[model samples]
Every structure is written in C-alpha cells, then in structure tokens.
Target: MIIKSPFTELANARQTPPSLVSEYDSCVDLIGCTSGQDGAHQAPGSQLAAKPHCMLALPGARNALTNAALAAYERYQMGQPDPRQLIDVLRFNVFYAFAHNAKVLGFNDDWLKYEAISPFGAPQPSPPSQPIAASCPANMKPTVLQMTVEHHPWIDFLPCPRMRDNFLRQVRDKGEDAVDEDGLCVDIVDAASARDPESVCLVTWGKPWVLSEWEVTEPFMKKWAWLLEGCTELMESTNTWRRKRGLHDIHFVH
Candidate 1:
C-alpha cells in the first residue's frame, strides 16, 4: 500500500498561525498522528524498533543544528545503528552543522553512508528530478535535488573536518583582520526557506519500543507539533515545485 505523506501539501498554502493550536491539533490528527504517537496506528509496543534497517531524520535547529543532529546520535545510543540517509524535509535557519554532529566522537566516517555529494567538496551527482520511491528496490537510497544541494552547505564545512580546520587555519594565516576586520560571519542555511514554513524540519521514525522507552513532556509535544507542521509545508512545496517543473512528486512510505 502506498503511504500518503502528511506533509506533502503545505508548501503552497499560508502557514498556520502559531496561535492556532486547535487547528494544529486537528491537522496532526488528519496526518495519522495523535498527541503522543509517532504514527496514527502505532501502538505502545510495536515492532518498528526491531527492524535491522532503520530510517532516521533530524530537523535542523535554529539556535543549533548541532544539537538537532545529536537527535540521531541519541537514537544510536538507544541501540539503532546510524541511519543510512539523512533527509531535510524543511528549510533550516542555520548551517547544516548537524552534519558535524553526526560525525561526533567515533562516528567520523559515518557521513560516507549517504548517497548525496558531500558538502566537503566531493563530486556531486545529478540532482534527483524524479520521484524517489520510499520502498526498497526503488527506495534503497533517498533522493537528492539541485535545490537540496544548493541549499545545504554543511558538506563544505560541517562534515569535512579539514574544511573547517582549513578555515580556521586561513583565519590565523590571514590574521584576525581576515574575519574580525572583514566582518565576515560563516553562516550556512540549507534549501528550506523562511518564507516556506518552519525554520527547520528535523524528525525520525522509531519502533514502538524506542518510542515507549522515550520520555515525552508537554513542552516537547507542543514543539513537536510545530515542527511537524514545518515538515509538511516543506514537503508540499518541494513536490509542488517538482510537479510544476514536470518532475515526479516525492512521497514517503512506511
């Protein structure tokens, strides 16, 4: 069965006002997620956690994409292996620093797992213009778009430690005037746009065990809904743009 994405239709519509909590709640229910569940039908103790190949996504954070990237690490700590693909379903207000976070500690080589071009200067393949199947055979890997490549700059400085190190080296080599006097700030923003919806759309799906083991607070729930709305808008805008360009629309399937 094809799983319709709850988020693929908001790109062209006006963003729901933040004060519209009731509207947001209704929208979440429409998407098959209630207040505390990952999916509409996902129960207290299902088997999504036991699957060997797990999918994880992290929404970029405004204050710190680094902290948001740790969402994947935290999942790994809970026993799921590092996800093979990291998707940005929404625009980010900050640099793709989450790439650096994914490389934290001993996971340095983990960035190599994804199929997209490394922002660290690796060669880039053609951006995906077709609908990437979310299932195996067609969905083994996530799709990449030109916009995604253009928008996400983490590959240049975040994952490539040398890239960042080189920048610092340049700063020292060129002297403080290079940055301070030049008034240069290294800011990176991924493809997601502020005009689109949420600032960052980071999220992941876990099995019931993982969800059950996790703690949920009221504050976290409110934030979660807000973020979910952002993801929806991003997906909608992405697919709508793709369709307008005569490309296949994107979708996610469980």
Candidate 2:
C-alpha cells in the first residue's frame, strides 16, 4: 500500500519546487517509513544517523532551517547591531541555498552506511571532571600568590600546565618594578580550572586583583583584556558540563 506524504499540503501551500518536495518525500520514506515494535519510527537499518545527519534530512531539515531563520528574525526585532544581524540572516540564506543544491544533486544512500560505522556518528562520552581545589587565601600578596602557584598541587589541573612556567618566567624577566607599575601579571590556571575569576590567586608579582577590580589605567587590562574575554567565554561553555554534574556555578567577578 502507498502512503500519502504529510508534506503534500505544505509543499502546495509554500509553492515549493516539485524536485525539492520529491527529494524530501524520499528522505522521509527512507528514515521514518518504518515503525518498530516499540512504536518508535526506526530507520531501515539498526543505526540512526548522527544528530547533524538527521537534522539535515526531511522534516528535521525543515524544522532546523525554520529555527535558524526565526533566530535571525528575532535578532532584528531585538534591535541588535545591523552587522551582527546581517551575519545571522546571511547564515540562514547560505544554509537554505546549500539545502537546495543538495536536493538538486540527489541523495546518496551510501553516506548513511559510512556514518553508521564512523565514531563521530555516535554520541561522545562526557569528559571526566577534574575539579580544582578552592584554596585561594584572602588578602594574599601577588608575589606570594605567584609562589603558591609555582608549588601548588592544583597547578597540574590547568589545560596547559606550561602556561604556569611561562607566566613565572615573564614576571621574573620584567622585574618587580615593571610588575608594580604596569601590572605585568597573568592568570595562569585558577580562572579556568577553578572556573571562578574571584578564586584566581595565581597571578604574577603585581596588583592583587580579581576580575571585579578593573582599572582602565592598568597595563594588564590594556594589553590582555581580549584574552580575559576569550577565557570567560570558554569558562561559560564549560559551565554547561559542570551544571550537568551538579557542580557549583562558575562565577565571574564582574
């Protein structure tokens, strides 16, 4: 028995090209045509396509594209900068054009077979949590903080432990006067591992400062503000994984 496509009315209403609609129907039939004993729609094979592959197919593709378009529209409504909104809108247009091109080129069933055996096609396991100790002493001097970082056991938890050595070397080469006057210090690891800007006690011989204590005149801010912003973004993304494990929220002083 032949089944009527659910997309028929949608295709007619949207005036979608016949070729594209036919391609969509084929994809739906390939993946969602069969139902298992559990009443869940299963692909012909045991393997399900990775999330991205599924998202690019049939009804999933339509929903994903629509969401992308709506996000761009919402950005415009919110009065975001024109350039930023332009990027968002252009992203939608580019993906829409790519989808059209893919439809015209025809579908490849072999791609599914390849994806089924690929490691990337499976969901990745979460990285094991490596929490840093909360041992930052209050009112610690910058030099003492540096020393503590050099000898501290938690220093090993940094993504790049070599950064600690580099930081120490730079501070030593710059001399104490430069550190005091220019704030020539770096946050080696605590801001990332501890995931709290306030817990950042591992800094060079300069002003003992937290993220909240920003000074425009400070040389460190003038030179490394962008680096700090980048690190904050990384930490924020890491917080999602941390939250799943019921870990404390990563705090940024500012």
Candidate 3:
C-alpha cells in the first residue's frame, strides 16, 4: 500500500523550486497515483507511475536528508561499504553535513571536545581522580605546588604491538628513505597535499563523495564561514558551476 508523506502540504506550501523539487514531486506523484491500486495501474504516466519499480522517498525529517539517504543507498549498491546500511547512512550523512557546515562557518573545532572560554591558552581542568601529581616525579613536591612545565603530549600513539611491528616491517621494506619527509616520496606527499586543497569533493571515512564544492578548490571548511546552509546551497553552487561547463547534476539510480 502507498503511504502519503505527512509533509506533503508543508512541501507544497513552501513553493520553493529547489533542486530536490523534481525528486519530491516525482515521488509524491508516484505515491498518489498507485498508492493502493495494486499492480493494475502500473504504468509510466501521471496517474500510474508507481508500479513494480515504485520508488518512494525514504522517510526523513527533511527532503535533503531523504535525498542524501537515497544517494548513500545508491552509492552502497555501487559497492561503497561506508554506507553499508540505510539507518546508519542517514545518521552519518546528517551528522557529516552538520559538522561540515559548522566548520565552514568558522566553528572549525568539535564543540564538545574543544572549548573556548575565558583565560585563553590556559589548560583546562582535569578530573580530580586523574591528578597530575600522580604522574609527577617524587622529588617534585605535589602538596606545595609550584610553577611546573611539561613537554607537549605525543599526538600519535601506536596502541597495538602487532601494528607497531607491522609498521616497522613496512618501514624496513621501504628502507631509510621511508622516514624521510623530503625523500623520493616527496612527489607523493606533494600530490596528496595539493589534491586535498584542489579537489572539489567531500571525504568521509576515507572515501570521496562529491558534495557541492564543484569548481571550487578549497574544502568546505575554508570556503564558507557559517553552517546555516543546507542541500539547496550545495546544489545551487554545484549546479551553477556545472551549467557554466555545460553539464548538469548527476541523477540518482534506484
């Protein structure tokens, strides 16, 4: 049985001919015509489009979310494993879009992890149970705390012994030049660095997914200064660039 979207009136009320309008309209039309008509009215027309291949828009808080879900599903069917399931993909896409947009808007750091408060540059308070005194030297008087200085923490920590051994093996295979920053791998390093800033795609979980940024070289973080935009802005920016190049946005396949 066909189910009508609860947002049908709201969608129509907006009257915005955004990029996803056609997709929504197409799906809505599909829902209305052959919702409960069984397989009898299954044809390609305004009144009978929802047939054996009935494509209902995925349930979501917004059409953009649904569109992203559809895109993720399409990508998964094409062999991308990051979006291995529907619900996970939907949640990830929403969060990704939110975080990406936030970075674009100048909130470049994670809100929960990174804090910006008064007394700038001062270290944040650690939990009482995890006192710094516990790790201090015996000669240092923990009771009468004086000025103390410590080396910066190492950011990269190899947690697994096997992984570390495997890394060393790989390094040995590559020779002394493996650890050199400006050695024979300079070209590779330069290529990777250059592509990060020059590429017009969003990277999620190591896989590249083309999101708006078309014609733009910088990542979304460096391009925009606010997270107040959504799919419409993305589509507009990318579509405008595509039109300039005599191309159009690619369609999603079921």
Candidate 4:
C-alpha cells in the first residue's frame, strides 16, 4: 500500500486535518480508566471521578491531530501516569492518523519518526529519474517519491474488467505546498520527483512484492484495490503527475 502522492506533513504553521474519526464514544469512565474500571466503582462514583487518567479527547474546532494530542495530554493530567514515552506516542499516532480519527496521539523519540519518512512497506517499481525539489536533507533514509495513483477520468472513459460499487481513492489536488502530520505546510514537490519506488516496496509474507497483492480479508484492502484498479484501468483514464510526495498506507512492523 504505497501512496505516490500521499498528504505531506505540516512542518510549519497552519495545517489541514487528516481525515480521521474517533474509535470510541467521546467520553471516559472517570471512576475507573487506569488501574482498571472496577477500582473506580469500589471507591464510589464521586471519589473515583477525582482520580486522574480519565479524560476525553476533544479537539473542539481545532484540527484532528491537535485535538487528539490535547485530549491525550488531558487524560494524562487526570491521573494517567507518565509513560515517559511521548515520542513513542507521537510516532504511534502517525501510524493511525491517516485512516482513523483519534483525540489522542502517542509520541516517540526516534529520529526516524520525525524525519518525514514514509511508512515501512512499498512495492518495487520504476523509480522516477527526474530531478525534483528538496524535501529531506542530503542524507535521509526514505525520500517520498513523486509517482502516485489518483482518481482519474479514465474510470468512466475506459471499460473496467471489474466494476466496484465501493472503492477507495486518494486524491492529491495540490502537491508542492502540502500539509504534514502536525498540520504545517512544506515544499515536498522536488524531493518527490526524485523518488525511487524500489526503496519503498511492500512486503508480503517474507518477500517484497513489486505491487501490492489484493487482500481478500480487510475492507480497507478492498477500497485500496478500487484505488489501484481505477488507476490501472486499461483505457479511458488519463495520467497525471504529483508535485510533492509523502508516505501513505504502507506501514507496520514485519
């Protein structure tokens, strides 16, 4: 699952929120969230509410990331002991930012976490030969590639071997000036053009696949397939280019 033109991280001020939704109802059981819920009941509702570690993630009108971060912080303030892992939490948040809307994000201290690196798995493909803008410093581990699959008109123009009622499509209307995880904008177009797809190939079982094999199990995979299928249409679709590149989909520990 590689997004040639995924949304960029906001390295500066002002940002666009990623499309994330919360996993739970917007509230925490104050009486018992930490050492387990049973303790709060034992202490009486009023006494349990005084305990920390029970807060809700509410962003108000702010971007999803900020709102979630603040909510996570508030939960800690309520009695959530310091995990001394803000860095890990932040890094972990990045893992879920794209698809889910969460009020709290975890943090991490790893240099890789903040290096603007894409997720771990991308399939091997023809790398772009064109020179592009500067995204990372001279010596960076993973540079986002400019190659991408967008929702094209070809889907309507070309006859499809498979007609999908439900599908997933990742669109990158604006590239160069894109937003990052923190909701800041940066110039990533140049670095994107110089991408080498081989560097981010997807992993399957123990081997790397040049392309993501269709997943038979998950709904996310089904939508992802619609995205790829729309792009790989035999005819009718027009090809476009992305000015900036960032990591999307393709993540997890193998």
Candidate 5:
C-alpha cells in the first residue's frame, strides 16, 4: 500500500528545524558506526576492516555478525556443528548475514530464505500460508482497497472508528488539492498519536508489527530520509493524475 503524508508541504518547504536536523545527522552517524565506521568493528586479530568510504555499503553488518557469532555459540553448546570448525562458522555467518540484511532492508523473510540464503545452505522450510491476526481486536470495520500491482489482497483494520473518521475528516478539510486518489493523506503526527503516545504499528500484507517512536524515526534519521520525500512526491503525482479521472481516494494504514 502507498504510504501518504499530509506534511508533504512542510517537507517540501525545506525548512527543517535546526535541532531536528542535527539530531538526524547524529542518528546517521550512529548507523554508520553499526555499519563498521569509526573503527567500530576493530577487534584483536579481526580480519574484517571496513573501508572508510564504504561505511554504509553493508548496513546492519555489525549486528548480523554478532547474531551469526551467537548462533555459532549456540550450535557449539548443543554439540552440533562446532564453531571450532571454520566451515561451520562460515556457513552460519553467511546465512545470518543474509537474514539480517533482508530484515534491515524490509524484504520478505521468505524471499531472503528461498531466493537469497538457500543457495548457500540446506533447503529451507516452505513459507507459511496462514494469515496473521492483529494482537488487539479490530475496533473499526476493515477497509479494503485495490492494489495497483498484482499481489495478495489485504484489508486495513484500525483499532477504532474515531481514528478512521479523523483521517476522512482531514481529507475533507484539506479538499481536492490535498486529497490523493492514489491513497489517503495522513499527518505523521496524527498517525503516531493514534497508535500510542510513543509507538505506532506498521502493517504489511495484513501482518501487523508495532514499533516504538524511536524505531519509526530511526530509518528517516539515517541514510534513507530522502526516501520519504520521494514517496510524498510519488503519491502526490499519482493522485493528481487519478483525480483527473474522477476516481475516489484510496486508504492505506502506515
């Protein structure tokens, strides 16, 4: 689903507050560190050394490495493939690296396993076909929208009708110029506050996952901030085209 924002005007204004800009820069730096910048990966006899210019070439590399190491340790404890064996460690590291990288890049888990990681290891289990249910009971009627691309059909189930109504009201108040027939435009602040004071839920393909405010903002604070603006422009442009055809506006849950 297309994620649309009402703050496109402000973002387009290019008037970000100085303090927020500085904070975003700091977060980018932190992500760089985790990507092996600032000698963050230096260890006694460590063979991995990140190139200065390639700090973000492998985002989430450090965490992936750590997880690989832990998985090796677990295997050792279970008297399975021992980490003492170089081949075993290599296999574990390669698999975990692909797995974690896929997660960081927001790829489907099955896609990573079957298409990416499977070639390096034993066959993976088939992806599950069961639909996931929301943790909390859905308080609002599910709203289904047609997808532009071929994919599984899904519906948005908000926690309450007030949240849904508020979005509709915002669209009405904003009028046609702000309304996008491609998707519903929502205020980021309103969306975040609707979920909780400190958290929000992002649903993909009917699966709901809750993320804290920090989790939500961290991506935008890092090297991917420009993507948000790109999405904003895409929605606006597409909606403008769709509106000319007198199509009704669509909705998406972020």
Candidate 6:
C-alpha cells in the first residue's frame, strides 16, 4: 500500500533511487527520502512516516489534510508494524497523526496505545493519553489536531522526570525551540536545543510548524524580548547546534 502525504512528490524517488532507513534505536529506525524543502528524500505516506520526518506545506501542500496524509503514505510504503503488532514510539506525540494515519493504514483500536514515557527535560505521558490516540475510557479527553509538535521522537521524556513536573519547567527546558512570542510554536528542534524542548513545544502546539520564523514572528529568540537579557538564546543555540546537523524531519501527519 502506498500512503502519500497530501503534498510532496517523492513518489518518483521510490520508483527511482528509493531511499535509506537508518537504525533509530533498538525498536525503531529513521527513513530518509527527498522532500520539497532543502531536506533529504521525503517519505510522505503517513503509515510509513514516523515522527521527525517533515513535508513542506508548499503551495500544493495546503490542499487541506490530504497533503500531510501523503507524507504518511510515503512512510507506509517503506513499511511499518504490520498493523497486527506494536508500533514502538519511545517519545512520540501520537495525537492527530496517529489517529488519522492509523485510520488510513487500516489500523484498529487495539493496534494503538497511549504508553507511558519519560525522557530528559521531557515529561511522562498520560495514564489515559499520549498525543493523538486517546485512551479508551469514556472519561478521557479525545485526541486533538495541531501542526506544531510537543516533542520530537528523539526527545525521551522517560529520562527527565523533574522537568515534566511543571508546564513551565518543560517550557524553560525544551519548549524554547518551538515556542514563539505570538504564542505560535514551531517544531524545529535544531541540534542545539534538541536535547530538551518539551515545554517549549507544548506551549507552541496548535500552530503551523516553521523552520525559523514566519510572517508573524521572527527567529524564536528575537520574538522574546528577554532573549538578550540573559543571552539564553545564544547559549541554547551553542548547545543545540550540534544535534540538528544530521537531523531529519518525520511527518506524523493526519
């Protein structure tokens, strides 16, 4: 089955040069392909696309939700958990993408779960929810959709207990990369601050994912008047710089 993001036209690549998949961890790995942006190959199929893989909402990409769905399909074409098994997501915010992508991939309810997790400067997930797929209990809140990511899959909340305790703590640690002064959070977890941007990501969720700044915002730090007060921006850029270098974007689309 070929699940393509509603946007991005890497379908030609799969038939031509194909792409590469690197081991992301013991249970997961990274798949790379060409995209519309200045990135590598784009696997637009939602079923095949794991988080961190990104697709551009280029002029054609804005075709409602299907463009993102195409990105998921690219990932699906590569392969997945085979629907009858577990799809390991160590720190994935599996909300809108999981639900919509699961539906697209023919996944039933049992195939997904909101597993508990904890990573550095990140927070443990819910007893009832994680990101996209909601818990079964009737009392639980159902899933919601957003463009910005609360945490990249590389962000392991299981290691960072202290930061998850407070929303602000998460903001101070991990949310810096994604959050902006206008309250829009973009999920550009560059190498520098990628170590911990949990809170920052959450605050900026529900907005478009931007590489740097958009028409309404400037580079994240520039939007924050206090960036110069303590030079936290420069400090974080230095620390996070190395991590974003070889990084690739995965689309957990809807």
lDDT of 2: 0.26
Residues 1-254, model 6: lDDT tens digits: 12222111222233222332222111122121122222221212112222342222122322323333334444556653222111111012222333333343223443222231122112533332234344322211222211122433322211111111222332345553322311221233211112221212211111112111111112222323232233332234323321233332222211
Over 4 Å off, model 2:
1-65, 74-82, 108-254
How many clashing pairs does model 6 include? 67
Residue-by-residue lDDT tens digits, candidate 4, 82-137: 33323222322222221121111111222112222212211333322222224312
Candidate lDDT (C-alpha), each: 0.27, 0.26, 0.25, 0.21, 0.25, 0.25
Against the true structure, candidate 3 reaches a TM-score of 0.18
Tens-digit lDDT track of model 3 for 1-254: 11112111211111312222211111211000001111122111124222221111122323443454455545544555231233323233323433333232233332212122111112452222223333332321111111111111110011112222332333345442333212211111111111211221221221111233222212322322121122344445545544533444532111
Clashing pairs in 5: none
Candidate that beats the other on lDDT, 2 or 5, i.e. the better one? 2
Q: What residue pairs are clashing in model 2?
A: none
Tens-place lDDT digits, model 2, residues 83-197: 2222222223323322322222232222122122111111342211222123432221123333432222221222222323434343355442222211121122111122122
- In model 6, where is the ten-residue run with the lowest total lDDT? 207-216
Backbone steric clashes in candidate 3, count: 2
| Weakest ten-residue segment in model 4 by summed lDDT | 29-38
* Model 5, span 14-72: residue lDDT tens: 22211111111111100000111121322222343432221112335434434544554
lDDT of 1: 0.27
> How many residue pairs clash (N, CA or C atoms closer than 3 angstroms) in each of the candidate models, in the order given?
12, 0, 2, 39, 0, 67
Candidate 4: Cα lDDT at 32: 7
- CA shift at 66, candidate 5, in angstroms? 5.2
TM-score of 4: 0.18
Query: TM-score of each candidate?
Result: 0.21, 0.18, 0.18, 0.18, 0.22, 0.22
**Cα error of candidate 3 at position 188, Å:** 40
